[model samples]
Target: MKGLALFAVAFTGALLLYATGDFPDWGSLDSPANGGELSTHYIKEVRKETEVPNIVTAVLADYRGFDTMFETVVVFVAGIAIIAVLRDFGNGSRGYPPALANNLPEEPDLIVTQTCNLVIPVLQIFALYVLAHGHHSPGGGFQGGVMLGASYILIALANGVEAAMKILSERKILLMAATGILIYSGTGLVCLLLGENFLDYHVLSRILPTDPIMARSHAMLFVETGVAFTVTAVMFSIYANLATRGTLKGGL
Candidate 1:
């Protein structure tokens, strides 16, 4: 059985390597991704069509909205799966194991706690800025959400998991995650109900005061906000579960 497994691994590895030989050379000017008609169209027309200064945001949130929506769903689903498998609702008071308990200090360091207290607020404020300004800049929902979630994780590390949970409780995490998905899906559903194809943001101009192009841009922000909410909730939930061995108790 061991020999058969080894053979299968080697054969698969060889096939994958051989297949890579057929791919275009790295960064070739004529490579499909670089020179394809679709790529050209996006580069030439994205800003004019969507009015979003950031081409990447316009593509992900407008031109390829369905794909990005599913990608967010994938992140949400992964968090849910980890929680379902590892969460221990009834064992909230169970502290860390003996090994971890011995290594950690009984009290959080004053300097570290103070520093985080100062830095965390600034960090979260910057996160909101990133999320709100993404269409016009380099940042976006995923990046902002990560920063927001890291604020909670920093609280956990500086204080304790329990301290962080006080701000973002388990119940809030689930609600925020579900609410993010709802916001994204609801936007598409509204479009559908308005007799436009799902996620067709141009149709939103009928309800919004903006013109068609601006409506698409504004709608993108809405969906991006939804993405940020889910990413923020899921990031903290995963850390809390892993750091606490699903009990969501005690420090890491």
Candidate 2:
């Protein structure tokens, strides 16, 4: 197994290194990716098409929404899978083997708790900022949701799994995850109901109180929010389940 793994790694690395020779030179204006017909079209048409100043956001949230939605589903599935696999069974206190469970400390560290009290709120605010700011600048749902989840993790580390659960319980996590997926999928269904293709945000203007271009922009925001909700909930759920063997009473 080790030999096969080593050979696979070496072959993959060699292939990648060989492929790099065909890549455009650093920051070359004439690079195929930067100067291609598609790139030129996107550069000229993105703002006019989506009304989103950030081209990356316009591409990911609007131009490529289908891919983004499925990727969110994949992340949510992985989180659920982690819970299914590592979850503990039988009646027992968790976070350690039965033999060690009785020896675990129940009290939280005061210093860590206090520090998190000062930091977590700010962190979550910043996460929301990132999620909302994506249309105009850097950062988006995935990045912001990870940041939001990390704040919860920090709380878990400072206090306990139970403490984290109090902020967002296991049942609520599942609900939020489902809700996010629903928001994403429902948006597509709405587009379909509007007599257009799935995820055709421009068609949303027929039902929405906005212009077609503005409708696309707002639809992208909703899509990003859906992504953020699923990402945040799934991320925290994975951590809680793995850290506490799915009991969610304590986390590392």
Best by TM-score: 1
lDDT of each: 0.92, 0.88
Worst 10 residues of 1 by lDDT: 91-100
Clashing pairs in 2: none
**Model 2 Cα shift for residue 166 (angstroms):** 1.9
Tens-place lDDT digits, model 2, residues 1-252? 999999999999999999999988899999888889988987899978988898988889888899999999999899788877776666554554655454657777788789999999999999999999999989898999899999988888888888889989988998998888899989998999999999999999998899999999999889889999999999888888877767776546
Query: What are the C-alpha RMSDs, in order, of all predicted structures?
Result: 2.9, 3.0
Candidate 1's C-alpha runs over 4 A off are: 1-21, 89-98
Among these predicted structures, which one has the highest lDDT? 1
Tens-digit lDDT string for candidate 1 (129-226):
99999998998889998999999999999999999999899999999999998999999999999999999999999999999999999999999999
Candidate 2 local lDDT, residue 127: 99
